[model samples]
Target: MSKTYTNSSTKFSFALRLIVVYLLQLFIKAFDYSFGGVFPLTFRGMIFTFTFVTYWLTIWYASEYIQKKISHLNTISIVTINVLIGIYCGLSSTVIYMLGDTYLFQNGDLWEEIPFYNPELSVALCIIYLLIFTVYAYVQKIFQLKEKEVNVEQLEKEMFKSQYIALKAQIEPHFLFNSLSVLSSIVHTDQNLASEFIIKLSKTLRYIIEQNKRVLVSLEEELKVVEDYFFLLKTRFGEAIQLQNDIDPNVIETIMIPPASIQVLVENAVKHNKLSQKKPLCITIALKENLIIVTNNYDKKEAEEISTGMGLSNINKRYQLIAGKNIIIEKNQDTFKVSLPALSTIDHENFNH
Candidate 1:
């Protein structure tokens, strides 16, 4: 909620800044003509000034809206569309103002020196205003693009921060305590096996630490971490936990995902499900139809693990931020599955820079 509010405030601030600049330009334009002494300071003069201000404001807003809506188009398309819109808005506002001036104030003491009553001058001024509107809109568009890029960079930073916290939580005391307990028993039984466990444990910890500097990792890189993680889990649980890897080698090399996403899903499965010698917890990792899928058989624990859902939630949020995709999660009586979009090399490259 607070983040949303901040984003809204930033947008409002940008718009208000543009409006202030626009009003100053309008004041300067009005002053240019008023200094000639043709324009007066009476009630009729005030109404004329207000009408002109309204006409300019209408063109400004219409150009702004059209520019934003078609920002994806080439520069030529944007300029052409904005030009047409500005002319239309300018003409419409000028005609409306002319109608009000001609019908509503026909009986008033009008000065011939004032161009407000001249349709020719009104049209000419509207054309000039349209040209100014174009330039102002173009400048605002450039500034808005810069601001959007900055916002995207900020969002990426926040995503990395969330991922760091999530990864750090995975290696904290509670998780280490379990691994250490398993290591302690193995060290006593088989020194050689314990040595292998120590190596795998260190590798897993190393991966988590390395991710502190990374927002995204290649699928193959992520799989290496998941493999090390599975090794530890298998060593600890023996035949009580089963994991299957069914990913295509080609897809693994061409796609990317948020670091530690698979690890989080595997840990989620381990944490939530029952595991026993007779009823092993089964988890599968696969790639299909441009998606990275992780699924597990349902064996929900009698006492659910204490959770804030930070891992999966962060992974979901990060995917939304980086890839503009959502992670799919489905569960039924027999299975729980998560599917994430596998971004292609081209898309991944674009996303990074």
Candidate 2:
């Protein structure tokens, strides 16, 4: 409805401008009516209308020609072309009026008596028309540029949203498969722990299902989900994994992060390392300033299988589009760490719909 109103308003404004130009042309031609005292009103009105229409049509054609053929012309070139076109249009109108007076009015004497070959008047009118065209062209160009900028901005936003969605899709299934594997291993050995794991898994799944539909979630809600995820990891890994969380409750309440982000990083650490009685895997999750830091002790053993880097890569891409910042990864012989910015700082927002 707003769009329709805008279009209607634009059309109305254009019509109003054209009408004003026509009236101005009529007023200028009214100066030539002094020869015959109060010339027949009908004849005068016809002449005024005809001259206004001719001038308007010529100006319109000149504008169209400039837009189509010589749009690339520089300011000086445009000015020159505009002036030339204006002179041609004015001269043509005057000559047509003279011819009309001679043939239709049967007044050859009137054309001969009056000095109508004044190039100065034609040049002055041409300059005035040229200024009008220049202003109109400049305004039109500004509008076109603004429209193009708006379109580009909208496209960029859509692309970012699509990329974030794709990244989310990649992370969800990968994490779900890993969680199910852990659940399967625990179901037979420890039924009680397995039941708790099922509850945590359900909560995690529910959170993912609900939050994935949103562009952003509250920081407190995401952190609660992460804590639930941590519980499951603790139950599965037992003493082999040590978890430390040092998050600011204030920041947690207001700041948001991508859903399941913490789980992905923790899972990455566990999947790619050996955690046993000999080498304990200590995972630390902390929020410092605006960053969420996940660091784990690195211990590579011959027994554990290495993981493909897809999870971390997807997380990185998601952060890139959402936060406009790269996900920072730090690795050495002893430690592997990832630093994520808070969700409030990222592209997450309330869903438009």
In candidate 2, list every pair of residues with a backbone clash. Answer: 256-343
Candidate 1 lDDT by residue in tens digits, 208-323: 76774555778999998888889899988999999998987776876888778898889889989999999999999998888899999988888975888777777877777676
- For each candidate, what is the lDDT? 0.73, 0.68
**Model 1: per-residue Cα lDDT at residue 120:** 53
Which candidate number maximizes lDDT? Answer: 1
lDDT over C-alpha atoms for residue 39 of model 1:
52
Q: Name the lDDT value of residue 43 in candidate 1.
A: 65
